[model samples]
Target: MKKSISNSLLLLSGIIILASCHSKKQLVKRQADSSAVRTDNAASAVKNKINAIKSKQVSFTTFSGKAKTKLNVNGNSNDVTMNIRIQKNQKIWVSITAVIGIEVARALITPDSILVINKLQSVYIKKPFSYIYTYASRQVNYKTVESLLVGNAIPELLNENGKLEPSNGNVVIDGQLQDLLYKLIIGPDLKVTSTDLSNQSAGQSLHIDNSAFVQADGRVIPSEIAFSSTVKNKTIQADLKYSKTEFDQPLDFPFSIPSRFSQVN
Candidate 1:
């Protein structure tokens, strides 16, 4: 009887041990399944957000906080500041001022053409959109400026068939061998995410949270945009703030040149 009792006790111990081990395995499996479900939910949310942005017909005014490198007779350095404006339907007119001892530059862009009237030079350079995009990277962020002119964001709005993935923490949109999506989230008061666009080239990144939001001409506009770019080994940063924004105001889209500004390209 003593031997039988001892055997029974040993059998009970073995069964308990096996049960504990099985429970642990089940717990691990449950945890993994939960993690996968969460990941799937997050991905679905991102896809939904993209769809929402695409479905909307949005008109907005923007304030920009910009940092950009100005290559000049002097040397390379940083400039930052605010610009304000209203933009819609591939047309924008903005006056940009600077901080850090730099002068303001004013610009107007349309779908077919871009007219940049320089306050410092007292000169106006008008050119086609394609020509400007190819040659203008040296002056401004070619991708961002192009998107504003078209009233849409690239890759987000243009590269509809690009690869979307999460890198680090931010979502990256990549196009055939070129990465066209980059953005930074900022925190402060104004609460905005600034973005840098390369449109398939190596680009820049920057952000400011407390930029500005302004109402203009019956529409809401982002009163500030912060930017960063790398043109060579140098990094350029900038802020653009718009004081006035107007939308649905009548102007020629793909604006035609007055004879005075007309020269066949």
Candidate 2:
């Protein structure tokens, strides 16, 4: 039972890539017409649209959500309910519950450390943040994780020099950051519809698709998110459907390993 709970927690952490941070920028008006004719200065228009999308990024000191998550890996599938909370640039807390609402695992992630307690096994794992790079790619970090969870442009991708192009009736922003190539698709509503990040030399790729945007606290946020990644030919996928979410709400992050529990590594 402990092994099962550990595996489930590990899988959830890998799939969620949970992290948090805050940034403020200007919001650009949403482009309502997808069929608008492109002018000779289409490049300028596209750049403006990308900028607007970045500007409207949601900023909050804290966030909390209850989600139903489905994870599939190498042909096996599992469903779990996650209670997640984020304190920008500080920590991410998650509780995983299994059958009959029994709490099985809890994780607390910070900028410098990762900690998970397997209540079923009475064991815990404590490692540095760098431990996550082993599961995904070297490009996976706190900022990227945070951005991915909230459906915002990754900081590294945003900083890179990029080109704007048209693809399948939407605007595609392409760029290379370090060894990774990224293509971001932006819709007429100025929201990101999808993002693809690939490192050809490493044969690793991460793709995220978001939809079902609804207004929350005066900000538009994606309620449905799909994440998929292929690392060394092993594929992992997760879909998150947030049922309740809010920002700036007072929340408690309680974590204490029982004295009887033993540490693993």
Candidate 3:
């Protein structure tokens, strides 16, 4: 009778151990599955956010604005007024005036070419669109310039090379697009707060801050923007505050260099 009782107790203990082990395995599997689901949900949310931002971009036939501009070049600072006009996807015209309302410079930029009139020097510069590369980085294009002026994300960066990361409650999209590493910080309101681009091999970088939204033509637009670019150890920074903004308005981009002005390469 004693031996039978001992045998029964050992059998019961083994059964209990087996059941506990099975329970533990099931619990671990459930935990892993839950984590994976959470990750998938996060990825989906990020994709949705990116799509929403793209859809909400401002669309218009024309744009005109007056900006209070402050420029800094190699420690020299000047305040000027910039009257800007844009025929969407066609041309951008700018007239820069001194503090006393004297026009000092004007520029006309098209998809293929760039022309500038320097009133102070009585010189005009005409070159292909690639001329911009002399001052800015090689990654800059016509679309890039248009997007920067309007606080829109770079179209090239929204591709497979970009990754959206959430850090410290900020949404940052960063990746290598071409030879440049770019990061675009987005605000909670889904607008771009800032953009940063750098090329390690070339020692070049561009930084832009976009802020102060104003509504025009049923669209929100950035009214304040700051740009800083460094190329080959030279740095240029400009801060623009838009006091007047209009969209879809009939605008004129008249740019004609004077015959007396000398050509600059």
Which lDDT tens digits does candidate 1 get at residues 1-265? 2222222212211111000000011111001111111112355654653454343223444322222222111133323222323343344444333444543344555556555544443434566555443322322333344343222343243234544554433344434323434442211211222334343353332222223444344422344444343433434333333323334544432323344542322
Best-fitting candidate, scored by TM-score:
2
lDDT of 1: 0.33
TM-score to native of every candidate shown: 0.46, 0.84, 0.81
* Candidate 2 off by > 4 Å: 1-5, 15-47
Q: Please give, for residues 1-265, the per-residue lDDT of candidate 2 as tens digits.
A: 4465467577546544442212222223445455343423366665556556677677888888877777666656767677888888888899977756888899998888888998888889988888876565677677666677677777666542577766666767788877878888877665778889888887778888877776666777777788787777567777777767788888899999889999987
Instruction: Estimate, for each residue in 142-181, the C-alpha lDDT of model 3 and write its tens digit.
Output: 7776676666787777654467766554567888867789
Ranking, lDDT, top scorer first: 2, 3, 1
**How many pairs of residues collide in each model?**
35, 0, 0
Q: Using lDDT, give the best candidate's number.
A: 2
Worst 10 residues of 2 by lDDT: 19-28
lDDT at position 216, candidate 1: 40
| Steric clash count of candidate 2 | 0
For candidate 1, what is the TM-score? Answer: 0.46
Superposition error at 217 for model 3 (Å): 2.6
Q: Score residue 45 of candidate 3 by CA lDDT.
A: 66
